[model samples]
Target: MIVGMNMENQVLIVEDEDSLSSYLKTELTFENYDVLVAGDGEEAMTEFTEHQDTLGVVLLDWMIPKLNGLEVLRRIRKQTATLPVIFMTARDYVGDKVAGLDNGADDYITKPFEIEELLARLRVIFRHEAQQLQVAPVYEIANLKLDTKSHQVTRDDSHVQLTQREYTLLLYLLQHKEETVTRDELLDNVWGVDFVGQTNIVDVYIRYLRNKVDRDHTPELIHTIRGVGYTLREEE
Candidate 1:
């Protein structure tokens, strides 16, 4: 039974041990956390990329097959600017801990950690994530404005209806205006790791956002970057 509600955010548990991963998954779920499990480093990367949008924290084992937790954490950090990652591994070397944090890990946990300690760390990460998201400024390009706080968008003073996914995509593009945000980046950052849908989903959503926000406007805000990806900026 759960000792308390998991007011902390969703977590992805990346551990190769079948028993430990399953136990963590069950415990976290019962405590009200949304959890995903990946047994290998490659799968962990895939899961983290796919679920990046909704994932608030990651519990990663430092040593694993395929990519290994350190490599996986590095890959995630390369794309995601400020993700909160906790290294839960037996590698307790000070050098290991420094390297992990230097490479983008938020915290480290040694093997045989108590569940309560894990929960406390998770709570800290979740609180930090919440604060960061709250402080991220709203982004705008052309006539489109996206208020990150409200997760709402408006085009030319008119409400442009968009699905939650659509809003996420739009906001991401707006954040990196003028530069092309790649399809793989979108797949990882917006749709997330658990999304098993077609890669073309990005294209479809782009079209939808364009039609709604730019179909009638004299200047378009979203531009298709041909083979690369999409860019959100003022039209030339």
Candidate 2:
């Protein structure tokens, strides 16, 4: 079981829009999340300070009153760097996305995005954090390591952050290390039978894993078998 998963199901929604905030609170509550709302930046900080320990995630709007979302996020980061914060903004510029990420947002969603997608992102953040807090085992290859106890990946002992999906995909590859595992096998095991629509997801995630786990490292561990699939093994 994921440690702290059940203990931290609360989320703070920092949006000034009444109708949208109310609607979101109702929706999230229905999905079993303890909902908290702060109409502006100051209130956002107050709510967060009070519930910092219990809070699992934060959904912050970019144009909130008093401090603005960016300022609020900065302040929150000072208090705690590990708390997950996702920016909800109307801005979709590449620069704006980079700024938010640089300012410590774990994710970003444009104003018109589907609620299901937002919920999905929240679930991913929760899963990742919960897994990080657990105590388990460690797997290693070359200079890379994955600690199941903390759900953290490290290269030469330096920490690497991964989303829940990416972590799961990596875990599966490690379990089948040194074997050329097929995409179909990966989808069946990693994405599961319910995964429909595309087969390229495995490829996409493999690329993601490479960028994080192998890019700058020597003796790259993840290898593609061309027409076959992929493998995780030490290459001499």
lDDT to native, each model: 0.73, 0.79
Query: lDDT per residue, candidate 2, 7-119, as tens digits?
Result: 38899999999999999999999999999999999999999888887988889999989999999988987766556788899997878866886666756788887788788
Best by TM-score: 2
Candidate 1 per-residue lDDT, tens place, 144-212, comes to 787755545778878665544455677778778888888989887765543333677688678777877
Clashes of each: 4, 1
Off by over 4 Å in 2: 1-7, 74-82, 101-104, 123-135, 158-217, 222-232
| RMSD list, candidates in order | 13.7, 5.4
Model 1 CA lDDT for position 7? 25
Clashing pairs in 2: 136-149
State the weakest 10-residue window (summed lDDT) of model 2. Answer: 1-10
Clashing pairs in 1: 50-192, 50-193, 51-192, 51-193
